[model samples]
Structure formats: structure tokens, C-alpha cells
Target: LAPMLERTTSAVVNISTTGKVVVRDPFFNDPLFRRFFDVPRQRRERRISGLGSGVIFDADDGYIVTNSHVIDKAEDIVVTLENGQRFDATVIGKDPGADIAVIQVEADNLTEIPLGDSDDLRQGDFVVAIGNPFGLGQTVTSGIVSALGRSGLGIESYEDFIQTDASINPGNSGGALVNLRGELIGINTAIYGSGGNIGIGFAIPVNMAKQITAQLLEHGEVRRGRLGFVVQDLTPELAEAFGVAHKKGVVVARVEAKSPAQKAGVRVGDIIVSVNGREVENSAQVRNEIGLLRVGAQVQIEVLRNGKTRTLTASVGKQLKQTVSGKSLSDKLAGAKLSEAPEDPSRGTAAGIQVVKVEGRAASAGIRKGDIIISVNRKRVKTVSDMKAAIKKNPKTLLLNIQRQRQGLFILIR
Candidate 1:
């Protein structure tokens, strides 16, 4: 282990970032008080700093991979090698939805870690996590893979995590999880406990990170594609009703008109078994499989329908952006421009309408820009049309379930 780590530790780098954040003050927000006191309206800014770890995956190109949150909003970034050499870094690209980022530094004689197949990993496999925990410089902790394909943690928009019992803590974000041979298998990202490790840590599988890194390097962003359908987990009751032998798949709930799935003959009541030859146990797996593919890529889908199995080939399509005026939906929602929220394939369904612009009655009702309308009058809405129909049914009273950042709130307008 010592010999292997000696060769591997050089590829793991310590990262530090500097940025600025606005300091909000209610006293400074009052127009009347500001006018009377003749005070300047410029907001206060505070310098901020963050620390984390990164892996030097492409040594020749000076490319490093790390967690997006580590470098998010950073104005300046610096990377320190194990030998005490430091180099300034620049962002190549970042995928916030997946919590993966690629940054580069111009340096010479760098060592790159060999990538391993995370799909080959299994429970109880010996693995080691290397990172700068709590800014204490490079540290290594050994553990076993506790679980695979872990999701629904709400940590990131897309989650197919590799769970381990390693000692991953603060400043370990974007570190490397390697096998016994020193091959990089995952990127350490999150912990299960409150600000500490509790024998449960999550890492982004290296396979998924590789896919995201390729897109970020080429396009500077990940352009996730969609299959043009919504699906729910296949319950035991539904599985029995559909004559399925096992309740391990997802049931097709809705298919968008003229979508690639529709064009490929996918329909409601179809039980999706797999995507591109990979078996999907749930909707999130299906979404993750399809979402990772590039737009226009051809995908083979297997479904069970009418107690028979069939395969369909479809092209992945780019997500559509549709917007509508608030007034068109309802008078109470006036002065707001709503659009379909960006699809999170990990969520396995369309989220809700986003308030892109808010003012007037919508603003007065406590709606703000960037707020997501999860439901209206207790009815779930995924698109502008859905919201319009929901508003029509409720007419007088408007009850909205909104997702504002990381919090959920309800607003009522009568």
C-alpha cells in the first residue's frame, strides 16, 4: 500500500479558491432612508475562500478534475502539488448538476493517475480515498465499497453515487477514490453525516465523471439529452397488473407528442426494462443512462408491454425550452414570465414551471425570479400548459407550492 500510494499521491492535488460574495443589509435596502441620509446604494462585498482536493487526470494537458462546488463562483484558483509546488489554475468547464468540474494549469513534469473501470467495482471491494481533509494537506484513508448505484440523496441534481465507509470530510471534495492497484475509480464528493463522515461517504463513479469530463472539455458544459417521456417506478401492484414477472423496472406514465420516444413507438403503459443494453432498475437509472448520452445519439430501449418484450431504437433529443406569460395563465399570476424548468435527468421527471421574471401581482404574491412552481392548487405541473390547466380548474384561489433554492414554501393568492 505504501509503494502504491507513493506513486498515486503525487497525482492528487490540494486546491484553494478565492471569490467575493455580496453582504446584504436590510437598512441599506430602504429607498426612503437611503434618500434621506444621502447614503450610497452600492452593496458590500466580502472576500471568500474555499479549500478542496483534485485529481490530475491528464498530466500532459495539465487537466485536473474536482467537484464543482469546490470551484463554484471562484474568481481565482490555485493548485498545490504534493512536492510543495503551486500553480495557478483556470476552469475548463463545470457541470453543477453532476457536481463535476475540470480545471487546467500550465505545468511540466506532472504525474497522472490511471483511470479504472468503476463498473467493475463491487460491494466489499478494498478501496482508498485520498484528499485534503480539513485543509490538513494530502491524507489517505482505506475502506470498502459499502454500496453501489446509490441515489435519492438530493445532494446533486444527478446522483448515481458509489458509497464507501472511508473517512471523507470537509476539504475532501473532488478527491480521488482508488483501487488497490492505485487506479482511479471514483471522485469523492459528499458525506452522509452532519459535516462529518459517519462510515458513509459518497463518491461520483469515475465512469460517470469521465463522461462528464469529456463533455466539459469539448463543449465547456454538459448538454444533457432527454428521451421525451416521463416514468414512475413499477410498483408490485402495477407489475402484477402489467403481468411483469418482477417489479424492477419503471412504468411509462406520459410520452411527449412528436418526441423521439413517441416517434420510436414508445407509449404509455410500457414497462421500460433497459436502455442501450444496460438494465435499469428504476426511473433514475433510466434517466441517468439516457441523460449521459449526447444529443442525437441513437439509443436502444427495451420495454415490456402486453406481457411481451420488444425493443425500440430512438434518438436522444435536446431538452425543449418553452415559456409563457403569467397573465395568459391567470390574472393573479400577472407580471411574471414562466418557463419550463431545466430538466434534471436524475430526478426522473420534469420538475415544474420556473419564474424567470417576476413583478407586479406575481411579485406582490411573494413569487420571485428563480422560484420553481412545483404545483398549483395541489396539482403537479411540469410545463406551462399543465400550469395553465391547473390554474383554470382552481379559478379564484391560487395555491402554489414553490421551490426556492434549497427550501420549499407555499404561497396563497385570492
Candidate 2:
């Protein structure tokens, strides 16, 4: 039976993408001497390859399933089959927030693997992974399901990842995590190496892949409904801070003016308990569910406010999209952009800034897209208007207290 299962592994393939990008050695578009940033000359573009395994998702046309991060910036992507046929693969669709992407190899009669139900998977379920790990080609590793519904890594913007211990490594970014039947159950995404694997690897559940892939095939992008409310996870101190006996659900710290949350009567200090009928345990879950919902979805969200549970129906708006490198639509600072908060609870930070737009000075200030701006001139800016007003009033020569990477950064807005 094991040998028969081993035979099915041939459908799995390796993916590597190459691309060129412009990067500043010190800073970008600097006023002084105009810093020399490396631009993608097409000639200077490096072979930016990521080692990941993919399952032959379709028997016809040869669709491959892998992590979005693997081929995110690839100017050219190469897919290698188990039977040793390599082809130039085109990206059909990619969900950067979900960390999943679909690629296609132009071939027919390809051997493909079947997909298993991730919703039915349980902890301690045995699984196997086949991928190119550490540049080693087509390696198979095995372990058990460590946990389910894992989140809060900030790895992908939206996450409800399947946690496993299948010996996934850096090269295993987009491999297949299979059930005992050799059916693709998950796409290996991240390794929980606090230092090393400690028995934790994350995979994009097959169910999510199916939905996202369909969207990608339909639209070149993944779109989700955005609930415009700033939120924070409930800490013990926060529970005491809000005078709540239980540290349950995320607390609405701020709501964007005219946002769906504000429009639906959601407010600061409200504890969000459920969305679309599913209970929200933490901020990650909230982000996950919201991301899963289509844009313009009418979702029913429940919140605990003033010691009472109240439900509100909200029509979600389209979430702002960014590039794989994390560049948003606008730039608020030379380094940071600020906007309304999101439904995903994983948004709040220790310093606290609701990052909304990334553009202009923010993008030029060596700041990334989606960064939360917590303070301005040493004063905490809690609302979108606050940051905008402060920046507009102060002009140049201000310090921005930004939150990203779960840490605080003071950027100079000159």
C-alpha cells in the first residue's frame, strides 16, 4: 500500500521563479545625490528562485498548486514534472494575502493527484509532504497534523492555516501535504521555526485553495470585503482596561469614519464575538473570515457592547489591494500610510496604528505598505483623521510612531 502511495508522488513538481526588481541600496528617490537604486534591467534581474513543491492540480492543461510567495515576483517561472518534463509555467492567479497561487504548464495527459478534505482533518492525523527542500529535489517527508485553524503569524494577510509536522523546510514553501491516500490535503506554506521546526509547518488547506484558485482563474486578483474597524486582541490588561470580566473576542479600538463598521453601529471598546454567524476567537480568525468573504458581501457581525451582545448587518466594502512586495495604493508618509482599520483582529499593535493607505511620502520614506502608524510627533494618533490632520498641519520635520513586524518604529517624515 505504501509503495502504491509512493507511485502517486510523481505528479508533484518543483517550482522556481526568477525576476528583477528595483531596490535602493540606502534609500529610494533620496533628495540628496539621488541615491542609486537597483532597477530591474531585465539583464540585472536575478534568478530569484524559491524552492517549493506543487501538486498537479489538473490532469489537463497541467495546473500546479503552490504558495503565492514562491512565484510572487517571478518574471519567469519554471515548473518541473515528476516524469522529468520541465515547462515554462504561467501564473493563473495568486492570492498574496492567502499565500496561495496557481500556475499552469502547457501539457496534456498529465498525471495529477487528488485533493482531500481539509475540513475533516483532525489533529494527530498522519500526513506526508513532497517537495524540493533546501534545493534537494522531490524529497518526501512525513509527520502528523499538529493543529488546525492556526493563525496570528502575520505570514499571510489572511490565514486559517493547517499546522503540521511534515518536515517542511525553506525549499518546501509550496509543496503538497498529502493524506494517507496520497491526495493533496494542503499546500506547505510556512515553517514554525522559532529556531527550528519544533514540529510545526503550515499549509494552505485544500478547501481554501479550491475557492481561491477559482477566484484567481476568474479574476487576476483575490478580492475580499473590508470591515472598516480598528481592532485589538484582548489581553489581560486590555480586559481590565475595558472593565470586562472575560477576555473574550477582539475589542474595537477605532472605526473609520463612514466605514461599514461605523455605519453598522460598531464602535470603540466593543467586543466582536461573531461574523457571518461564525464565532471569532481572535483577531486572526476575524481577518481570515473577512478575507474569505467576497467583496460587497452582506455579513452579519455580532458584537458585545455595553455588556450586551448586539448583532449588526454590514455590507462589506472592497478591501484595498497591494502588491506582493507590500505596496498599497497610497502613501501617507514618506515611509508610512494611514487609513481605516480592518476586520482582521491581527491588525492592532503594541503602539497602535490603523494602517490604511500607503503612498506618497510614506512609500518613499523606506516604509512598507500596510504598516500601522501609531503616533505623530510623540502624540498617539488613534483615528484616521487624527493622523491626516496632524500630518497636514505639521508638514515636514515630524516623527511617525509606526507599528509593523509587531514592533514599533520611529520614522522621520521630512
Model 2 stretches astray by more than 4 angstroms = 1-4, 23-47, 194-196, 229-279, 300-314, 320-344, 350-366, 379-398
> TM-score of every model?
0.85, 0.77
* TM-score of model 1 vs. true structure: 0.85
lDDT of 2 by residue, 25-98 (tens): 33334455343545432222234556567788787877887888788678888888777888899989887778
Give candidate 1's error at residue 104 in angstroms.
Answer: 0.2
Residues 1-414 of candidate 1 have per-residue lDDT tens digits of: 999999899999999999997654557655578777977645567899999999999999999999999998899999999999999999999998789999999999999999999999999999999999999999999999999999867787678999999889999999999999999999999999677888999999999999999999999999999878888888899898887796688899888899999999999999999898988887778878888999999999999989889999999999776668999989999889998974443453348898867766677678987688999999999878888889889789999999875579999988
Find the candidate with the highest lDDT and give its number.
Answer: 1
- Positional deviation of 276 in candidate 1, in angstroms? 0.8
Candidate 2 residue 42 Cα shift, in angstroms, is 17
